[model samples]
Target: MLLLFLLVLFTQNYFSHGDLIADTCKKTEYPRICVSTLRSNPDSKTADVKGLVRIILKAALGKANTILNQANDLLKKTKDRLVRQSLNVCVSVYEEALDEIPEASVNVGTNNFEANIEASATIDIADDCEESFSNSPFTADNNAVKQLAVVAVDIIASLG
Candidate 1:
């Protein structure tokens, strides 16, 4: 009986994340990233679609802040005025993204279309930042936030 109970518990734990995160993430462009990230968060073990949006948006916000800091740090180190200018552009968009993410978080399930618009902006922010670098941008960081934001937007659309 104990072994059967354990097996049931294990299966419940496994399939909880499996079905919820899987169904949602399959709708995203980057399914692996979405599943891995959502599964990494303890809260996601039981999260509904709205809860998942909160988690992804939070991750996007953190990554945006990290990339903003990287751009600022590079800005200070560079001697070339052109590189500094590009860094400035990155810095600006990241700041704009920072503002949008919080708003997105607030609107998550209430009016998901609003959340979708805000989440959509993060993808553009990453693009603009990368374009400004013209060479080396926060490739990984930007990709992380962009993919997370895209996932959030797609999920938000699903809610509405």
Candidate 2:
């Protein structure tokens, strides 16, 4: 009987159901902790944090729209050197960021990984040049290009 019990215990250890009880217990406890931690009082600073975050997000969106409108207006109205230079700077920074994506490749063989390793290096220098610098706000001469640049500017502004 002892030997049978030992065998059962050993088999139980090997035939794991992946600790579902423990996993569920951990997941269940977190939501209770979250609910308990929420501010009980409306006047408390902790309660006000969410309100503040909303306000900040709204303000940021407003500012981005204003700036984008101003940029469009300026680009349309003037051929001023300073405005052109600032647009150029924006384009330069965008292009630099694009240049930094890693290019990679992979090789697979039918026999084994060893055979794959022996095979020639298949190069894949990703020419993402169009995607990378495709977001320049100053490149919006045509309607489609202007739309693309506006979208990029909106994306960048939202990150702030």
Candidate 3:
């Protein structure tokens, strides 16, 4: 069963009827301003496809780090143990999300699927973080969790 699911996912990602990879590459241009500032100069290290993927990875990582830092900072400011615990989970999720990229790169290669992989990683990280936050010590504080959720959503949106 697991193998079947894996096969389905791989096929859907790489050989779907639609060219989601190309579409995602096109969307990467939307964050050119953010990418330029966050990554190295826009010099032609490679073709636009690879260059754009690099930019997307850089920008997504930057956004993820920023969100994680904000959560940590907020936790530090608050003495509430629940908030601190939730923030710790958020931190862990961000770390795992960041950690997955290198492996994903190896799996998908740098030339293609980079943007798609980054987006998928961001979504996974956000979902995991949100789930962890909601069920932990901070279950009562929906408002703060909502704010963190907004940050995750913004990070995903910014990537596009």
Q: What's the lDDT for all of these models? A: 0.90, 0.30, 0.50
Residue 48 Cα positional deviation in candidate 2, in Å, after optimal superposition? 3.7
Answer with 1 or 3, whichever has the higher TM-score. Answer: 1
Instruction: Using lDDT, rank the candidates from best to worst.
Output: 1, 3, 2
Instruction: Write down the lDDT that model 1 would get.
Output: 0.90
Off by over 4 Å in 2: 1-47, 87-160
Give Cα distance to truth, residue 65, candidate 3, Å: 1.0
Clashing pairs in 3: none
Name the top lDDT candidate. 1
Q: Write the per-residue lDDT of candidate 1 for residues 9-121, one digit (tens) a residue.
A: 99998797679899999998889988888888999987888999899999999999999999999988989998898899989999999999999999997878889999999
Clashes of each: 0, 0, 0
lDDT of 3 at 135: 56
Which candidate leads the pack in TM-score?
1
**Better-scoring candidate (lDDT), 1 or 3:** 1
**Per-model TM values vs. the true structure:** 0.90, 0.26, 0.48
Query: What local lDDT score does residue 1 receive in model 2, on the 0 to 100 scale?
Result: 100
Report per-prediction Cα RMSD to one decimal: 2.1, 20.0, 15.0
Stretches of candidate 3 exceeding 4 Å from the true structure: 1-46, 105-119, 131-160
TM-score of 2: 0.26
For model 1, the superposed segments whose C-alpha errors exceed 4 Å read: 1-14
